[model samples]
Target: MIKKMSIVCLMMLFISCVKTKEEKNFFSNGDFYIDYYENEILIRRDAFYKKGNLKAIIEFKNDKLDNAKIYNGKKLVSQYFRKNDTLYDSETYYDNGIVIGEGNVDRWCREIGWWNYYDRNRRLFQKQHYVILNNSQLSNQVLFYKNGLLDTLRSDIADIVFYKDKGGASFKGKLIYNRKLNEKSYVSILFSDSIKDDFSNMDSVKFDTITFGDKAIMEFPVIFESNGRKNIRGIVVEQYAKEENVGDKPVNMLERYMYIDKKVDFH
Candidate 1:
């Protein structure tokens, strides 16, 4: 009986030593291990590190990766996918795990837009807009200058209305003067009249002509003199009119003319 008791004690000691050795070897190998409760329920486990960096993470079911934190070299790096293993969110970190950036995806459901960018200091710098379009070929683009200024804006729609109902239309173009009104301001008009059934062909009512000042009273005749020099001379006219649609009505008309020196400076 004494010998049998001694053999049992020795066997128990050996088993304990073997278990301790196994635990130590598990940790030394730099691979993560899972822990459990008395009822074999899972609990949280520490992530393994190799060469001062994170290697792998050991997971559990009850208190598992769903609420666990991931680490790399003692720095939190990422959070694992959910229980379904369909999605995973990962984050990059600086040396001290300062959370440089993070990204994730939903693999099971519809694709969600995702974008990320980092700055020089490992911080988020630029974020992109991701959206699904009905036609992938048609996409909106925005441009910016180097100085962060908006230079020009344009769209894929026509906004200018020049003509409608096959009739004549009017257009206005402004000439912004820099210093003085030395150059002429061009004014043009187009007209289309209905005759039998369709409208008349398009025709220009007026063309470019030089003027004085901002008002219409100071008119100048833009012509080329005998000296071959193009001169804008001030001319006065009583009235100017063209043939009207009426025949027997007799459109009343008057005419006047005033001429200015070609070399005169109206400025």
Candidate 2:
């Protein structure tokens, strides 16, 4: 019988190579969809809950978001990884899964460096420290309690403040109506060459040119020249105005950096 029809065509090619197919699609957060499995491998991307069940699964590879879990019924609570695509490594649990919080986000999604919190008896309580700078500024943040003390420091931008004059490198600053500033402003102090250098080459070193009277907090006095191997790097803010007649150019608007050894006492 032609060798039993060649053993039934090798058992139908091993049952079509173990069959597996899914193929779902459209998921730009419109409540999730993406699934694709044997069609080309997208692995997961699901979300449900309006009478259905499962809430999140995410996982993807060549498509991006590498891992995610989140659930409530079967209890996974939360999870994250995204090895690359600008960083994510997150975590969060507590629905019995414990973990509470853990972090490292970047690609403009802020939150970087140390972040840990836990309580439902896992103890550790709180601790966040995101100092970030040229990574697009989170510029400073600190908090830590649960006995480690320190508590709060946060400040993403109050527009400008500086104030340090420890008998030397000088600084006395001000500016406040920040909605990005512009009642005639232009402050500078750049000066890099490393501390992670990024202002495309940094050099300015000193500048003022203010103009916001009636006590809208204008104060200014910048004085620079600390080249004992250079270090103060950051504090720009510009925008001096001149609409249809154009003349006194300035425009840039805000840049801040500190903590490369705590320059100007940005402790």
Best by lDDT: 2
**Candidate 1 off by > 4 Å:** 1-32, 49-64, 81-85, 105-113, 120-123, 127-267
Quality of model 1 by C-alpha lDDT:
0.36
**Which lDDT tens digits does candidate 2 get at residues 181-251?**
45444433333335333232234334333444334456677655442332343443444443434467654
Task: Please provide TM-scores, in order, for all candidate models, with all chains considered together.
Answer: 0.30, 0.32
In candidate 1, position 130 carries an lDDT of 26
> Which digits, one per residue and each the tens of the lDDT, describe model 1 over residues 186-235?
22222112211111121322323343333433322222223332232222
Predictions in order: lDDT: 0.36, 0.55
Residue range with the least summed lDDT across 10 consecutive positions in model 1? 155-164
Error of 2 at 262 (Å): 9.4
| Worst 10-residue lDDT window, candidate 2 | 258-267
- Model 2 TM-score relative to the real fold: 0.32
